[model samples]
Target chain A: MPASASSIPDTVLVSADALHALAVRVLLRLGLSQAHAEAMARTIVAGQRDDCQSHGVYRLLTCAQTVRSGKVELQAEPVVAPTRGAVVRVDARRGFSPLAFERGLPALVEAARTQGLAALAIHQCFHFSALWPEIEALTAHGLAALALTPSHAWVAPAGGHRPVFGTNPIAFGWPRPGPYPFVFDFATSAIARGDLELHRRAGTPLPAGCGVDAQGRPSTDPLAVAQGAMLAFGGHKGSALAAMVELMAGALIGDWTSQESLEFDAGAQAAPCHGELVLAFDPARLAGGDPAAGQQSAERLFQAITDQGARLPSQRRYAARERSLQRGIAVPRALYEEIEALGG
Target chain B: MPASASSIPDTVLVSADALHALAVRVLLRLGLSQAHAEAMARTIVAGQRDDCQSHGVYRLLTCAQTVRSGKVELQAEPVVAPTRGAVVRVDARRGFSPLAFERGLPALVEAARTQGLAALAIHQCFHFSALWPEIEALTAHGLAALALTPSHAWVAPAGGHRPVFGTNPIAFGWPRPGPYPFVFDFATSAIARGDLELHRRAGTPLPAGCGVDAQGRPSTDPLAVAQGAMLAFGGHKGSALAAMVELMAGALIGDWTSQESLEFDAGAQAAPCHGELVLAFDPARLAGGDPAAGQQSAERLFQAITDQGARLPSQRRYAARERSLQRGIAVPRALYEEIEALGG
Candidate 1:
């Protein structure tokens, strides 16, 4: 849907269902419960539909390897603890993050309804997918939500050379009375590591301020940046945001910081266990005693932006989803074969 | 404290108390009540102590003029309405934002303690100061806080020509068990409008991607950018954040959007009325029933960053505050005289 690998002669077209079934079969072979496999497969397919190939089947092989390595507990069930009236904590027991989220989100939404606002902290899980889906799910329940998580270290501080922070991503969702929710997710780094890797694969130069060379000099060479470190986007502002995410997702959740993640990754090839923070706000309770008024306000704001010819965040993803639903997903033939072999 | 205009030879040193008294006197002359004047003056003095010169006395003259022009109600009191168990809405009665915050923050804090999380929305107010102080107040009461506010539109959306978004600022505060809370505040724009005005005054070139020229072309000329529009930081990512802030502070609060503010400002030189959204989280309640564990985790995260020789956000402001507290604030001679004259 988003300019597939047309240059590759071995590109293949597959239906979304087929892709999902293949992913489930491969994950099932690698020792995952039917439910867990189905959950992970749905996320991967959604990523493909939304044009985020890096988060799609591109990571399936690695996911299978990680599970095979036994670093991720195949049979793990999250322990959800409601620590307070509006605070929910989920210990993922070193399992998949999606399952933890699935286990805790309903309770989190319920808490928000009762207390006006609620927070969900998920720790000891491998989160290797796009965050939008999780926040999107909250919006589906007519709530405003924010989600943040830290990954393995790749980004450097604004002025410093070494990588000290993760390419931390933050996502927000606002539910209007309209048909769809307004949502967006982005990494705090100048460029996502996946994009940098794509540039390297294409033999393209990176943009200015994207990353630095080994000598701590700003470089446009993707290889040099890959070898050195990525810079935080927008200089100090992005660095500050990355730091905030570290506090919220890592420290507040009592989970691994970027440094800790790196240390853990040093001894294993599996994805490092991470943490997530999700916040839900009940508009009916917070919007001056009338939720309809709040929804109308959101509608007016969205109209104002669209009137200015300004594209809203996640518009492209939604467009891609529409196209993918009609045309099916495009997968590279080589990758398809690899997945097929894994299924067998 | 922050390398004041000592090179200008006309810089004057003023004690913090004297500065506060002078600001209060000037505002009192402009028809603000004693309580309102004191509240406004405290914010001004705090801005100076923290080295936020643009938010300090530099903007006091404009504020007085706006209030005199009847754009800001001088004697109005904020009306606090508890919409739900943990949500409060403060209609500022078209008065000052600081007063609205002062009126609602106590209830908001109490709600957070009772329910683990709470939100406060303030609308119909003139907000012309740094947001850190309000969030800092929450931290002082041992709460983690987040605040956002929208201003008059000046920034262009990503990949768009015309200005459609405000330089919406977001602030976050984490109250550690340490002596000081970790806090950071930043505008979503590539640079704060105040700093851009400073660059224009100095005839300096803007940084890459800071803004665009009159033709919607990216320009480093501060004057051209002044004539045109500022760009969002980190391109699309920052634009999305600015949009999120517009929704949270503008739509969610049922207040004027940035475009509405601009329309209102079109007929006058007064500062546009804006809105603010503040959220408080009680760490003791939300941090898995063990507040000390949360504190230790935060300390570890901070140490990890410091170990890389990377400076923390607001480290400079904290340092400036220490120096200003010890040696008093520095003011330009002409500005000092202007304030002294206004007080009379």
Candidate 2:
């Protein structure tokens, strides 16, 4: 792989196909269906290709453990039902989120095209994968999309000392008349939980306003924050956004809130079972019935932003994907060995 | 009047009705139709009732100045046209936004109720009022709503030196089966331009991360920030949100981006003529024709938030509204006098 600035000498470089095969093998061994396993593997490969290591093969071990522990059903078949008007619902049957999304997204997109807008409410799934893939899929089909989900609580509300919110994430994608769509996905917290975990492992200090210690005092020490609560990214504004996600993904979907998810986990090693809300909009219909006008508007917006020298969101991920395709994906030797052990 | 903690002897108290009458009179004197003037007055009154003084009567002086300067059209009628399927468009006819909204919102709500979701794109209007009032109106009709709008440039990109974004506010409202809907409206900037102006007038230092100095260094001096650029609320994440708003409200609505708005204004004292995009979702359709279930989910979400002692968004505004009803809206004597001068 083209070496990352932080890559060590002991890192293992594997072709993208090899990494996908490895993930599929391990998931199949855990009793996943052939189609389900392959879908899961593709998402893992996308994560690795995009340089989101936390959501890549590093999550395979937990997936195996969760399936073995019966927290995530191995052969569950998600059921998709058309709700009133253009809304659809997916009962994940406690399976992985990828399978549920696979079954629901096509219908959602069709509904949006027919009705101008549509919504998908997915529940009873473990959504540990990156959100960008799903939104990107919608944009690739010439549709605009927004997705929100609440995870287990790791963030504290503004002025609060305890964890009451998740690293609740919101993702949006807009289809333009170009090869790449405008996509952005981010957690509402100051940093992702995995990033904080890395800082703790390396014994590094975090930036100011990242988190608070057990006594609610601002702290740069990652270990202290791990033992306490992480702060929302932008004080009250971030807190408001986190709460909004909770309401949209949790309550609106009739699924567990972040606090409820924590209780459901009950100290388990598996990822939390969460809900996801995805919205798709057909800009062709919204742009006075002219699809070209909608695409032109999006192109104009991209030009305006780029002219200001502002980096488009997810631009780095696309760059990383190109490098990984040219060379390979770099993984720590230890992690690769660990995955190999799980496969057998 | 129930006194606010920050209220001083220089504050003048007026009944909400009287304030509304005064605003209507001032707009009518500036050549607005009676209906348009009354609609505009109601929005201004709502801002003061909700304790948002920055968007209340304090803006009347500038409103008059802009109208008298022939920037904001005084007697324009908005046109609402159904584009395709559930989407609708409003040509604001270069008039006030309140009139456009007044004419278009009912049709937008009806379209959403029929199609499960609808979008309203408003253009060629100057939008200067608080967004909460509009979104709250949607929730009042049992519809979930989201609104985004761009303004004059005052915020810089994450690492860029000069401003390329406006405050770029976002507002959301979730309908619940309760006395009030869950609502939130906030600027993507660390602090709003009006709030920064207040700090500058008071000769006070701003909080950390609020803005950058002319040299692109973080500064606590409000004066320096006023002369420089405001920072996005949470670095890159906030910057992405501001850009998203600009795309949706500016390019999508065929209006001006923040930079373009500045160029159009040409250093005028009047408010920038911006665009707005409002989305309405009918939960009755999304909840599988069972609106009660949607309401119940919202109620459960609110309960969970309140159980954690996390303040619900807009709770403060509701409390302020109650207090204003019991007593009166507190306005600075100078602002009241300035508005009175506009009436003559």
Candidate 3:
């Protein structure tokens, strides 16, 4: 057993390294190939490092159960192929979305070189966990990227009793002259089910209008929200956006929308394959051959905001990240114990 | 006077062709060259046909006034150039956004052929009018597109007393397998000024939570909404989206941002040029020669809606367009008289 596994539950000092390694081991035990296991582990671990516990290792146990139940494929490679221009299509073959993204990003990034802006849409893939990282990767390459995804389960259409829509998220990032990209990633829903779960666990009331009860009336109890449908952020507009994502990803990419009754055959456990679309543009394409000039232009704008005494969008999140990094990743004591007991 | 213009009293029953021609005549009368006048006319006509009355011929008077003041260069040509890949930049030179787009579209279309997607950002340009027409035009060529423009004069930042943001609008369209593309265009504001004006004219009550009074308290009076700052759609989220558009169009394009003083130059009714960003993509590339198939799959999922049997987002809009076309465009009596006055 790893030495760190012995020290798991007693203190609040879980090293990021230990978490990553453990996650990787768990993935391997769940039958992922070595490379894929490592990739999935890193993505989820990074999510936790960024304080996205809902998308992080906390979901790994569910993922494992899903895998054992034959829902998610642990060792499937994406079918990546080029079509026209800088566009590429990937059929995930019931594989993990992170794996699909890992395979597709290189091609999409390289395509941006010749196309100025490139796009990729993946169908038949499971959750990629977090959108920010995918967009952040493009930003690292000095590209402004936007990504959208549709879900296979867990949400309903607005004004409808049946679950027919996914939370459907949108992620966008613009490369800045600063150390980090200006990134915005959010679901069209008022709040994520994960957050509801967290509040339910903590016995906290949800913010008003976040969700509805099973009967579709406004409810503040997190547990009811978890069991019932989540409302779109605003009324019609938010629903329109979520519906747009459904059309863009599920419809445009040729995936099963959540509205279709779950097929319980060979493909039933074949990872509730969702749909994803990514668009990345190179800013240099418009900066008159002087990449530095575009950077300066963006910098000046940022300076204007700072000088005018306005805060950047992710400033608070960045601060939280810094604090967590300085200390260590936080985890519940019960969770750490459970992870230790599940060690293969 | 055109003979057909006489039959409609509190209205103008002009053909699309007739309207375009008259718009060109008006622009030329305001000192624009024949070609620039035609380009601007076509754009405005397109907006009218698309039902974007607010940005259509409704603004002709203001545009004429601006042109007379030499705030808008009547015959100025946009400086069109390429960026890295399929990116084009147009220095509008205080020209109309439509003219900027007209000069920029050919290159962008060409870029889309080889780049999968083309992105164009116009700096120092006047209002582009309704975004739907631009999107509609692109969709005519079987492309998916999105356009964003930051209006700097009419919206308030979240939790702020003064209007520091524009009703900054975001427009996105996708070519479905059906007759018309799915287009969604709306301002980040709770309600557009035109909608409020309509409410005021009809003596209708404004929707709650849509606007604030002079003292910054929420108000349901359309008049108050017009006089005071409009609320954002979904509180913090909508505010964030508006801020994003400002950053993308104004800051990224080196135009302007809300963080700067809203008052540009008094007596300068000529507002500083706004920034416009347009993105065009070919879904066929990402769909791998199967856009129709993908769209079909999406339709199945979307149509499974248990609410009203799965309706498309633009279904109502399309039906409205069809009805309008069949019954002739419905114009308010006051607006009809207003345009008739323009002719005189």
Candidate 4:
């Protein structure tokens, strides 16, 4: 099939289907179970759907290579069980995150229904792109949710020279009365480490303080940022947030901090250790039988704001989702060519 | 007793007692209940001990004024109950946060034990000082936790002005192998609004792109940052995260967005519509009688990093905590004089 160029200038967009097919093939070729491959592929495709191409098909090659090298186990199955006080812990057994989360969330949901809320700590898992989709699953069931994942590399501690933490993204999803629910997700780093790769490929300059040079001083060179380390967002505050996620996701799950787990040299590999922390709450617990009424109040408040010309959170994304669905999800020729090459 | 004229240097150490006494007096004079005054005072002072001065007694004057204007119902009692799910909600009755949280957390604790994890959402609450302490309370029971709060003002949506959000902050804590567990809390703004206030008072300059003028142009002038609006920490991503908090903390709780909640003038009293989200999980649920073993693994992992001369999250605050406990908490002379002027 002929490839189409991405409409987003400077960005190469690939069709979700093409990306998913390539990702699944790569994962399977790397020895992942068919189910795991499909799940991982879907996750990667979701990232692209949400304009997170850096985490989408772009990551497939690296993920496949990592798995093939045994840096991320492909055959592992998560072992999930109930913990004290409504907590559920999943020993991901060093598998992909979707498998762990899929196994863990049911337990959390069951517990939350009985206990009013629940938490799941999935330890020793591989990456899951775009947390919003993960948390959105819970929000769909009337549960408000938050998720945190600690990465294996690319952040520095405050005032420190060396990279010692992950970008450490936190994501939250809440059901609202709007046409679409509001969701927010972000990394603690000033810029996602994935951007470093894009910058490297495109020969673009990075924003200052996004990362450090070889000497550990701040730099705007993508190569240095990738090789040295990414800086935390908001200086001390961002560092603190990153550090917090390390404790919550890494420490709680008995995984090494991203800094310690990093294998910077291309030939080096990270240990099979990563974790995610998920918390779920049913807002019905707060609104009683009057959720509709409470939502009405919220709608009224936001309507007042809209009356003043303010847009609601996720409004743009909601619009984009509709447009994308209507337009059959556009794919750029450049990204499609890359995917074709990888698949071949 | 005559006030001591001694200076605490870069560290303005004050005894916990003196700080609490002064804080209580100020709140009481501003019309808070004795119990509310005490809780608020302790929570605020606790942040000072943790070196979270921005969220500590530093905001006392604002709270006092907030209470004075009847925006905050000083004696309001929270309404707590379980909803359809095991979830618990606390209506702050438009009161101060410490009191509201003190009322809400117990419900969350009870709910978490049965649910394995539970979330407490407190709505219409005034400012809560330093989210770490609230998470600390959960950790005391050996529970890992996450907490988030929305500030009342001084942040803008990405590429837009008009102070549409606050320096929303998030905190996460985990229990570990020592007397001090890991705790991290920080704002999502490039700089805290309080820092801008400090700059305004001290005649200092802000780092570039910290905020923008009223016309939505970037500025390094602290005064403008205050009167105009601060930018989200990492541009688009940070803005998205803050928007998520708005839904979780504001819309979910039936409050308006920060922009909508603002009263006419920027500095004048705005409607106190802040909300908090808390999640707690017990590690034992997943440990299966091997809590210590899991903790040991986590401890070893953290120790390995520290052995390499890497600092753990909150290490500096823990050090400050010890120093304060041993040397007595310090109070700035100016603050001391200000407290004395309150005739405590």
lDDT of each: 0.82, 0.81, 0.70, 0.70
Q: lDDT score, residue B328, model 2?
A: 88
Relative to the real complex, the DockQ score for model 1 comes to 0.53
Where is model 3 chain A poorest over a 10-residue stretch in terms of lDDT?
Answer: A1-10
lDDT-wise, the better of 1 and 2 is 1
Model 1 lDDT tens row, B1-344? 22345645777777898899999999898898887888889889988878788888876887976876677889998899855767878998888778889989889899888877888989888886788999899999998889998888888888775677889999999987655689999999999887887889899888888898878888989999877889988788899899888878876666767777777777576776878899988877766646677678678777766776878888888898887777778777888888888899
Candidate 2 whole-model C-alpha lDDT, 0 to 1: 0.81
- State iRMS for model 1: 2.1
Q: Taking the tens digit of each residue's C-alpha lDDT, what string does model 3 give over A79-166?
A: 8886467677788877788888888888888887666677888867777577888988898888878899876445655665445567
The candidate 4 chain A region of ten consecutive residues with least summed lDDT is A263-272
Poorest stretch of ten by lDDT in candidate 1 chain A = A1-10
TM-score of each: 0.93, 0.92, 0.86, 0.83
> Per-residue CA lDDT of candidate 4, range A1-344, in tens?
63333555434444566667777877777688887888788777776665555665666766755666656768787898645555778888777788788778788877656655667888767665668778877877777787888776667666665667788888877766444665777788888766777888999999777888768778888987778878888777677777767666665555545644554224555323567878776655544445665566455544543553556555665676665555534445566566667666
When summed lDDT is taken over every stretch of 10 residues in candidate 1 chain B, the lowest stretch is: B1-10
lDDT for each residue of candidate 2 in A232-301, tens digit (9 for 90 to 100) = 8888889889988887787655676787788888878577787898988776655553556545655655
On the 0 to 100 scale, the lDDT of residue B252 in model 2 is: 51
